[model samples]
Target: MSAPEDRPLLRVVKGAPDDYQLAALTAVIAGLASVSPAEDKAARRSEWANPARRVRRPLQHGPGAWRASGFPG
Candidate 1:
């Protein structure tokens, strides 16, 4: 059998949606979009709060370690 080709779309209506419809739509929207800016910032901060998970760890420059690692001292 052939696959379906039409994409689903949302239509504007004059009246507001019912409680159930609103909840379902909210869930769907939440699933599609990312968290709020504040929440995202908090998440990033939490990640960086842990030293092991940090993007830049303390560099160990023993003698010429920096030059050996291809980084200018």
Candidate 2:
């Protein structure tokens, strides 16, 4: 008997899928498997909730300090 690691990644139990259909299914599964949990969480994270936003920018101490403060870094 073949080991689990040597088994096929997918099996078509019901219908016979065409080459294109099988390729699409394989691509989708491979794409999903490539993304790590950390990357998935980062992708779902909101820009507003970013930790970088919490960190203050360096204070510009020049003539345009006040004006610069009004604009983002």
Candidate 3:
């Protein structure tokens, strides 16, 4: 791999850095901010559209099975 490609996925530079480093950090921050809201909105909309999807009560007591549970027919 080339030097650039061989670099770690994440890098931390201590102390002061050049303008390029600041620009790169700013770009990364901006990119993250741009995508985060869309992702959150999509997640919220999906939750609202599909919901948790819980089973209704009496799932195990379908139809006339409730009559056998000791309650009045």
Candidate 4:
């Protein structure tokens, strides 16, 4: 017989053993709370803001030597 390979994935097992997941979530929440509110707000804002300082390499084609800028590859 073929192995069971068609089972669907479950985001959360209902009424099942979920203590680990709950523990992990609690840990994450605790960690987040450990940070200062101002610092946390700044970090969250930065996460959405465009990154600063990027590498620019001159392209060998196009009208002028175009350059690409952004986080390092």
Candidate 5:
């Protein structure tokens, strides 16, 4: 079997690329390799869909009860 170092990093199947073109291609490939992948962020849960929201708040008695009911706990 051929050694790892013996294998070419890239190969030209058809068209012949100049030194500058090959250099640009190599730089692009190297840049892509160096970039870190974006983090897998956890999706935010909507407040409206929360289980706590589904549960009813305790009933308040007396003055301003109507106004309080309009507002969130």
Candidate 6:
């Protein structure tokens, strides 16, 4: 195994002196790593285009409504 210093990302992390800088760099790296390829990404949508996919329930008397919504009885 090579020394951590020999690895580019590890070298950068090890060279970060401040705790805040290390934290910020880690967050940035994590965010970048989470990015999906363009073709695999879902199209931007403001709302569910299909009404069938939306949750629908008639407004009713109090506690029973909570039960239907999957809350503890």
Best by lDDT: 5
lDDT of 5 at 1: 96
TM-scores for every candidate against the unseen true structure: 0.27, 0.46, 0.31, 0.28, 0.60, 0.35
**Tens-digit lDDT track for model 2 on 1-73?**
9999999989999999999999999999999999877643445778898998889988899898999998987
Alpha carbon lDDT at 64, candidate 4: 40
**Candidate 6: clashing pairs of residues:** none
lDDT of 4 by residue, 1-73 (tens): 6566765323455665578977786788778879776643443454435464343454355544344223333
C-alpha positional error of residue 13 in candidate 2 after TM-score superposition, expressed in Å:
0.9
Ranked by TM-score from best down, the candidates are 5, 2, 6, 3, 4, 1
Model 3 gets an lDDT of 0.64
Taking all chains together, the TM-score of candidate 5 against the true structure is 0.60
| Model 5 C-alpha lDDT per residue in residues 24-73, reported as the tens digit of each score | 99999999999999999999999988988777889788999999999988
State the lDDT at 8 in candidate 1.
40
RMSD (Cα, Å) for all candidates, in order, is: 14.4, 9.3, 12.2, 19.1, 4.0, 14.8
**Candidate 6, residue 32: lDDT:** 87
For residues 1-73, could you state the per-residue lDDT of candidate 3 as single tens digits?
4798787665566778778987798899778877744443443455545645553344346776756666533
True lDDT of residue 10, candidate 3: 51
Off by over 4 Å in 4: 1-17, 37-73
* Model 3: pairs clashing at backbone N, Cα or C within 3 Å: none
Error of 5 at 72 (Å): 6.9
Query: lDDT per residue, candidate 6, 1-73, as tens digits?
Result: 9997786763453453678877887899889899986676776776667766575655557767756666523
User: How well does candidate 1 match the true structure in TM-score terms?
Assistant: 0.27
TM-score of 3: 0.31
lDDT of 3 at 26: 80
Q: How many backbone clashes does candidate 6 have?
A: 0
Q: RMSD, model 6, all Cα superposed? A: 14.8
